[model samples]
Target: GLIGKQPSAEMERKYSNETQVTPQTPPAFIFTCQDDRAVHPDNSIRYYQALMRNGVPSQLHIYPKGGHGYGKRFTFPYTEQLQYLLTDFLNEQLSK
Candidate 1:
């Protein structure tokens, strides 16, 4: 619910618009859902794309299911796997 429960259209637009622009230093990894309809998955995808295009060293994990919300309740079967993936990603980044 922490993802898109907020009912402020202005805030939503602001958040979406904010990520469209790439920052000087992007994080090494970004995990998001591809079918996130409420918050617009393109935001993460675009950011990831921008990072890749600029060679910022990052990765994106897009689940085929699950919309907004559903942070870590394991609503989907692969949620635990995602956690492992995140851990591995962080470890890899730290090792670098």
Candidate 2:
């Protein structure tokens, strides 16, 4: 719907990050919640798949419950797990 509302082709192209993904794209840490209402988890899954197809290093974590925008929120059920995953990803990246 938003794509149809774009004023011009340039505006659409400017936000189409997926089409721009390539081997040169930086490594990614993709995290999403399956039940998020704000943004669909499939977007993350597709991005991770794209990164992998291009041979880029990436990690994808899809938790079952947390809705959306739960970053650093202690009350989120997966807060500790998210922290561990993110920290481990950063450490692994830094070692490279």
Which ranges in model 2 have alpha carbons more than 4 Å from their true place?
Answer: 1-14
**What are the per-residue Cα lDDT tens digits for candidate 1 across 1-96?**
334667587766565633444555645566666678666677777777777776677778778777777675667756788789888888887887
Candidate 2 residue-wise lDDT, 1-96, digit = tens: 345654687865665556678999999998889998877788788788889899999999999988888885767898778789989999999999
What TM-score does prediction 1 earn? 0.66
lDDT of each: 0.69, 0.83
**Residue 70 of candidate 2: its Cα lDDT?**
84
The lDDT leader among the candidates is 2
